[model samples]
Target: MDVDLPYELQLVTDLRGHEERAWQIAWNPVEPLLASCSADKSVRLYNYQPSNESLKFSHIHSIPTGHTKTVRSLAWSPSGKTLATGSFDSNVGIWEREGGHDGDEEAADWECMTLLEGHETECKSVAYSSSGTLLASCSRDKTVWVWEVHPDSDFECMGVLMEHTQDVKCVAWHPSEEILASASYDDTIKLYIDDPSEDWFCFSTLTGHKSTVWALAWSPKGSYLASSSDDLTIKIWKRVAEHKWECALELKGHERSIYSISWGKGKTGEESLGWLASTGGDGKINVWDIREPPESSTGRVLSHKLIATLSSAHDVSDVNSISWCPREGFEDLLATAGDDGSVRVWKVVPSH
Candidate 1:
């Protein structure tokens, strides 16, 4: 057995709230809550207190969506009051917490405010933009849809993007811009920017991966975008021209289809450059240090090191989703869901 690794995992807890596969997990940006959805046709929210001795997750609430199928993805609104969910039912549900003010949000009742319908088949993913003004959803119908969130919880169809020849796998918005990116089973990634004349239009089509592109994540500063593919590789792209993008780096280390990738700030580096944590079908969590050389001023990445590799993170159960805790007290913590029907929190020990 290999020993003396660079990182060690402390099993925070084996969160077993879902009877079926835990498909996706998300962290609320404004609050200390974590939301997870599963194949059991339900959405579960938990309030996590890192210092709790025995019980780490205080079960905040659980809502049985009553969808005909599985809940596959989740995205919380910027204010943390609204949650958008995508599911196999071919519909998007917008949930809002009711009667909850600043003081007692935990006791607020969550109600399904509205449902957005248009997808021809299973809705694979949904994401809210940084401003919370737009929500994007991708479906197996091979199309991407953008919605305009109104002040009264009503949404209007902003645009439908149909550049992908195959099923759309995931959609992600730029960190601080209105631009959006979508990955597809056709092995292509498309970037869309808001156009003044036409609502939203595709400006770039990124094609390099040999197989289906499963997921895409924008860097914290929006300078780079990382895409994971079924071909067991991750490609990082950056905008070079006005709307064109060039692949800045290609990371190939995973053995199977890469499912999830998250960009975050590295703990001990220049505040701008960050690290990445990815988990996938190979059931391994790989953290990378993406940075430039010392005293280098060209603003170009020199090398990326595989700082930590934790194999069988979820007991080799096809890890599906991972979200690094962005809170100040839990910078090294990550929440992951897998086919084992459980959510596990692991702390990264960089000192190891």
Candidate 2:
């Protein structure tokens, strides 16, 4: 809790669960659920409760991903029913909560529904498309894979994109379109879209990062994409036209490799994309306020204000992942995973 934030941020809770570095954390879109995957080869799910204006969490489930190696990433389905975990073991596990029936209590039994296999090496990241019909995963094998998820947990490989020259670090989908984006160790970001023939193909490759591109996030309206990199800078890109994206701005401040970034409105009832959060190997969490373009600014000329910087965000460990809580009423809440093997929650409240 550094006192230098341009905005106020309060540490709500430090969730202790994983015995190894927690690599990723994701929030359930429609529930109090927060799930974290770790190098311990396990996924821990917690139920977050808001009590007396503070965030409290109860560990509801700890699942063995059945991987021989680190569970590196986690993604929840749009319906908030399924959790997809990617592992260094080269497999993906899909988990679901049982006993969600009418009379069941708040706690539900969790079970791994299915295991998706195919990547030759580490499955670095997994993401569900906005529609929930498609899942996209990237790997250290330097490939981006898309799957068509069917009923009864059946998944068919829709496409395999292997254009990146090095390890693919993260994959993200457009908010309202079938477009997919992947960042890689090759220092580039590639965009893909579905063709009418039911195929996914790369449409554009974004360059300019000086080192490995670690993670990516899309804006609330899907108009812009933000990327974090080993170059220690976060780059913003705007869609200039269909199939084309241009660099909007390059943000520099992190002292080491940035591992993850997320976008949030930072408002409970209001509709605004107020800021973006980025966490890095430097153990700091930075809040970059997304500002409106200047009145005289032309298209795609963006600006950002550094509103907050929380030092030692993970207590002397690299912060691996971060996500802004998607629950409508708790938009200011954030979850972060780190090398410290713990998941911490924070809430931003106006400091005035």
Candidate 3:
């Protein structure tokens, strides 16, 4: 940890269960659960209790995703009833509780209800829309697929977008809209929206990063986007028009490839929009407080201040992913996945 920072990242607990590299960690949108996918071909779910003073996490269950390869990514539905797992087996698995419960019980068994197989190569990422009515996935096949979520865990592919020239690394949906953003090995980010009358199509392509764009996060209000890249920098893009988004700010601090980033509500409330947390091969976690510039500022100005830095967060191993807790009263909490096969929970505590 950097002593000069105004905030400190206090390690709450270490979750040891994955037998191989933990690739990604995601907090349940509506439950006290955090799900992590691993190269061991399994996904582990942990239950957490958060309080003002401290936080506690316990391993609850492990689901053998049966993907025959590494589970690269996993995401929870907005209702926290369904889990989607993407794998190198070129398939996406949709999971639900054994009895269709709402995750009220930690011991409830889970089963894979559906397998959506269309990608010809490895599936890299999966995400659910804000409304929970749609799912988006990307693959090494250089395609992005939108799936319509139906009753009884049924999924229908709505579109197969072939925009990225290389493997798509990640996919993220706007916090409050149907728009989707995808980062890729092609070193670009593509924004897609549905015509409703026709199908989903790319409306904008953001190209500023010199290397592969690894991850993307949207502001709380969905007005801006933050992207991390293998170029070792994070860029903030602002929507200047109905369909145009331009790079408004560039942040450089990481010493290696930036793998993942997340934006969530911050301590400063709505005025600051949120804080951005990023981590990657540098084994460091950096948190920034991003604020919109004053109304008089020109060029859609924005400002950011680094509030905290956690060096060697994974003890010499690369940190693969970082995610912010989205639940009320737990906004200060964060979870990170490391190549050392451990999941660590942390809280951003004020130094003062």
Best by lDDT: 3
Q: Estimate each model's TM-score.
A: 0.94, 0.95, 0.97
Q: Which tens-of-lDDT digit does each residue in 1-352 have in candidate 2?
A: 5456557667988999799999999999988888999999988888876688676788877887688999999999999999999999999988887885442425577788889999999999999999999999999999999999999999999999989999999999998899999999999999998888867889999999999999999987788899999999999898889888999888988899999999877662333446799998999988877765856777655767777778898889999998999888787888899999999998877665
The runs of at least 3 residues in candidate 1 whose Cα sits more than 4 Å from the true structure, single-residue gaps closed, are: 1-5, 52-55, 100-106, 293-302
Query: Scored by CA lDDT, what does every candidate get?
Result: 0.86, 0.88, 0.93
RMSD score of candidate 2 (Å):
1.9
- TM-score: which is higher, 1 or 2? 2
Candidate 3 lDDT tens digits, 270-293: 779799999999999999999998
In the range 235-286, model 1's lDDT, one tens digit per residue, is: 9897777677888888988998999998877575564357788989999888
lDDT, model 3, position 82: 91
Worst ten in a row by lDDT for model 2? 265-274
Report the error of model 3 at residue 173, Å. Answer: 0.5
Order of candidates by TM-score, top first?
A: 3, 2, 1
